[model samples]
Target: MAEREWTTADFDYDLPPELIAQEPVPERGTSRLLVVHRTPGTNPPREDLAFADLVGRIPPGDVLVVNSTRVRHARLLGRRPGGGPAEVLLLHPLTGDRWLAMGKPGSALRPGKQVLLGDELAIETLLVRDDGFREVRVVGADAATAIERFGRLPLPPYIARDPDQLDEARYQTVYADREGSVAAPTAGLHFTTELLDAVRARGVEVVALDLEVGPGTFRPVEAEDPRDHAMHEERFEIPDTVATAIAAARGRGAAVWAVGTTVVRALESAGEPDGTVRPGAASTRLMILPGYRFQVVNRLLTNFHLPRSTLLMLVAAFAGHETTMQAYHHAVARRYRFYSYGDAMCLI
Candidate 1:
């Protein structure tokens, strides 16, 4: 039999509005974990467990890859040159003092228009791109300092509230180091320092890489056929040290576990046919739809994603479409928190 052609609708499931998590849990590693097994012929057994139980679930000597991209204070509150309310969501840097950003009240982004960022800094529009990004030049201060001093945390729109002090800490991972990403790698949010220590004690090698996650992570798949959707590109870096560790683990017959979809994209983009990754910095637009062969990651830990989302499609590719959909339906029935601040599912 030949493979079936799947559409965007085939990858979606019904999720209730109430299940969408508006806030993070009181503590890390306390969220529920749904373990989905990959058995080809039968309905896979999904064990509902706590996130802390992840240490026991993996075999020793496996390489655990995580994205250490830090979420920057990308949401900036500013005003137009005439004092009308203005907002800028910094996506990434372009050149010296210039950044790729999206602004509100599109009229405020005309060439040479200036948006006063704060008492110390302002941004002047340089150029606008077709994809809704504006090339703006910083004035009076560097981009980093301006964002740090006055920008607010760029929480996703579904949260239905402003970013508070609590989000300052809870929205990032414990090991987050590189300052780049606009959105949090939610899968990594479930981990705690104690849980990591426990995983290390179990003989698993934890490694990190940088993939500056972009706002595209929150976009839904609008095309009827998922193949028609254009995947977003993001920058990623895998150092030689992490590459050597991954090769050593694979040589020893150990599995490579990806902590989140962001890590999956980085690893697989650098992945070679032999399952070893090439260490270097690069940007990727790799879309992991069903039928795409995974080169590096063996086990995956990810959060519950939105319906008809690229993240959900990537999960379907890894865990089998039937199994992934089954897991989502089960999660809905069981009321597992959904989206960025939600519970997680581990596919083994």
Candidate 2:
């Protein structure tokens, strides 16, 4: 089948509500791993294993590419000037102190209006956008500082619980540095500092990239036809060190395993048609569906995603749709955790 002809239903699968993990497991590496092997004309049965066994699966000299984009406290509680409760989820920063944000009853916020974010924090609406988002300039304190004090962790709506103190650390990866993303890279959340050190000690090279996961990542694809879906561009960067590491790994015939879809998008976005990856920073709106040729990633590490979600489509593109769907069915039957803070999968 042609890549562009893929439909959203191609990625659809049933998931029981009880399987959706509302909270993370107490032990980071104690979560289960479902290893799916891909081969021509056959769906390989998944191997159930613990997360700690992941390092053993890595071939020597392989490069693990990870997205180090940190999750920011972007969910802010605020009020309209007249004191009505309001909520704002910052999508991305525009210019200066301005940001593109989605607010509850966002259409009610008119241009030039001021919203009180906290006791002393506020934002002045500069313009209303065509997409119903608001362009607002932060007031009273630096945007970062204010968010640190008042913003809550932007947990996925399905969690059904308030953000706890543990979330501030558990939700973030050990290597996170760039503070721009509102959502945590779920795949990276499984790795602790000790696990990373162990992987490195095994002679597996680890590299980092930056892809600020934007609000669009959480937005469900509304198009019945997957081709009609417009993927929102996210800013990403591939440092020289990481680029060099990938090149060296490929030269030695070692696999380049991406830690998550974010890393896959970043690497594939920077890769040439000839499969050579370059070092650079740019915006990527690339969408991966079945029959899409992969230029860089050889293996994928990811969490179970929502049904009919773009993330599920990307995994289907990596491993065949039939294989992925069957694995999902098995996961549901086994009652493995699903979604963010859920169980993981390794596709190779």
Candidate 3:
């Protein structure tokens, strides 16, 4: 039989708007979990459980990799020169208080002018990008400090509401400590300190990696051929301890579960040619489509993604394409929440 050609449309599904999750569940461990068995012809194919039941789903002594990059308050609402409304979303931090960010209505923001975030925090526009991003220099205060004072949580656009006070804690994972990412690793958001303690009590090996997610994560693949879409390079680091654990687990024939798409990207990007994980700090632009082989990440735990998104393609790459499509249809039929604040699907 001849192999099939895959396009961006081949990876999409219809999701009703009401299923989009606007807020996180009050309890972190209370979200619904849909477990998909990867084997062909498995009876029932899907199992529904609470997020807290994850301890039983994972095999004992297996390695679980999580991304610990914290979600920063990256969306700044400010004013342009002459009092026009302006918005800035910090993308990546550069040296000496400069940052790469996307400026709203960027067409009119001149390079030499400044955007005022607060009474003392101002950003001087250094470069105006044709793609709607701006290179700005934080004039007086540092980027981190300014964002902490004037920025809101940079939630995905699908979530159509202002963030509430609870979002301050709910948007971040319990283990998130390193400050870098603009978006939360949504899959890890389901774990509570108590739940993590339970996971450890079950003899699971937990490892941490850092993948600094950028604004490009939310961009849709617009090319006619999905292969032509370019992925943005996000910085990542797999510490030596995590790398050692992953190598040992692989040697013993144990599985490694990546907590989110970001972790999947990081582990796969850092995989050695011999199939073992290596420790290092670097950036990755690796894009996983349907035909791309995964070098690491034996199992995947991820939130439902937007239709036709790169994230959806990555999920399809890990799970079989047909299997993932069926799972999405099932999730929709059951009215499971969708997108960043959505329910989870664990493929094993």
Worst lDDT 10-window in candidate 2:
1-10
Predicted structure 1: clash tally: 0
Of 1 and 2, the candidate ranking higher by lDDT = 1
Lowest lDDT 10-residue stretch of candidate 1: 38-47
* Residue runs of model 2 more than 4 Å from their true location after superposition: 1-4, 41-44
Put down candidate 1 lDDT per residue, 1-348, tens digits, no spaces.
897788999987888899999999999889999999977665547889999889999889998998898999988889986779988888899877789998788898877888897666887889988877799977898887888887899998889989898898989999999899999999999999999999999999999999999989989989998988989999999999889999998899999999999999999999998899999999999988989899899999999998899999999999999889988999999999998899999999
- What would the per-residue lDDT of candidate 3 be over residues 1-348, giving only the tens digit for each residue? 766678989877898899999999877889999999989999889998888878898888899999999988888888876788888888887776678888776643558878887678787888877666778877787876787788898888878888889998999999998988889999999999898888888889898999998877888899878888877779999999999998888898889999999999999988976558878999999898877788778899999998888999999888889999999999999999988888999999
Which has the higher TM-score value, candidate number 2 or candidate number 3?
A: 3
User: Which runs of model 1 end up more than 4 angstroms from their true locations?
Assistant: 41-44
Per-residue error at 283 for model 3, in Å?
A: 0.4
Worst 10 residues of 3 by lDDT: 101-110
Number of clashing pairs per prediction, in order: 0, 0, 0
Which stretches of model 3 miss by more than 4 angstroms?
Answer: 129-132
Query: Model 2 over residues 1-348: C-alpha lDDT tens digits?
Result: 433576787777877788999989998878999999887654446888999999999977999999999998998888887778878787788888889887776644678777787678887778887776789877888778768888898998888999999898888988999898988889999998899988998899998999998777777788999878878778999999988888888788999999999999999999967555889889999998888889888999999998878888899999989899989999899889998899999998
lDDT for position 157 in model 1: 81
Residue 82 alpha-carbon offset, candidate 1, angstroms: 3.5
Candidate 3 lDDT (Cα, whole model)?
A: 0.87
